[model samples]
Target: MKCKDCQFCKYEGAGIAGGYKCKHPNIEESAKKYEQLKRKVINKDYPHIGYQMIKTSLRYCPYRIDREESL
Candidate 1:
C-alpha cells in the first residue's frame, strides 16, 4: 500500500512516492495550459455606463471616468 498521487492533483495516481504526492511534470503542464488563456475585459469599448450600472457591474471599477462634478 503506497500513496502515489498528490491530494492536490486533479487526477488520481496509484504510484507510491510518499503516499499520494502531486507529480510536478503533469501539474506544471496543466498549470501552464491554464495560464495560456487570454483574460477578457468585461467592458472593452463603453467608457461609462452609469452609476447604478457600474455598481451592478462591480465595485472595483472606477465610477468617475469623464465627469465634471463642479456644478
Candidate 2:
C-alpha cells in the first residue's frame, strides 16, 4: 500500500505514533529518519528552541496542537 498523502508519516516514530502508511518505502524512510532525529536530540541533551531542540527535549512535538477558529 501507498503512504498517506497527508505526509505526516515523515514525523512518525520518535514515538510520534500517528497515522500509519502500509509497508511503503516512503514510510520506512520516514521511520528511519524520525528515529535518527530522536537519537540526535538525545545525544545533544536537548536544545533551546525549534524542532531539533523540542525533538530532543520532549518525546513528542507540541506542533501537533490543533488550531481553533474564533468565529
Candidate 3:
C-alpha cells in the first residue's frame, strides 16, 4: 500500500516540495534521528558526513493503516 493511502501518513511542506512521511508512534525515534541528519546536511556542519535519506518501506509496511479503514 502507498503512504498516501495510510492513516499515519503526514504531508510536510506545500506545493511541489511537499512529501509524505509516516507519523506512527513506533517510528518516532527514527524520525527524530532523520531530522537531526537532515539539519546536519542543510547546515553543512559535518563535511565528512554525506547526505542521509530516510528509508521507509511503505509498500509492505507492518505499521501501515488504511486511511479509509481508520475513518
Using lDDT, give the best candidate's number.
Answer: 3
Is candidate 2 or 3 superior in TM-score?
3
Q: What's model 3's lDDT at 55? A: 49
Model 1, residue 30: displacement in angstroms?
0.6
Model 1 Cα lDDT, one tens digit per residue, 1-60: 111222332333344322222333343333333334334333421222232212132112
The per-model lDDT (C-alpha) reads 0.27, 0.29, 0.42
Which has the higher lDDT value, candidate number 1 or candidate number 3?
Answer: 3
Which regions of candidate 3 are displaced past 4 Å? 14-18, 28-60, 64-71
Model 1: number of backbone collisions: 9
TM-score for all models, in order of appearance: 0.22, 0.24, 0.32
User: Candidate 2 lDDT, tens digit per residue, 11-48?
Assistant: 33344343232323243343345456556433421211
For candidate 2, the TM-score is 0.24
Kindly report which residue pairs in candidate 1 clash with one another. Answer: 3-19, 3-20, 4-15, 4-20, 5-20, 5-21, 6-20, 6-21, 6-22
Total clashing residue pairs per candidate? 9, 0, 0
- Compose the digit string of candidate 3's lDDT tens values, residues 35-68: 4645532332211111222344432233432332
Single out the weakest 10-residue window by summed lDDT for candidate 2: 62-71
The candidate with the higher lDDT, 2 or 3, is 3
Runs with alpha carbons beyond 4 Å of true place in candidate 1:
1-21, 38-71
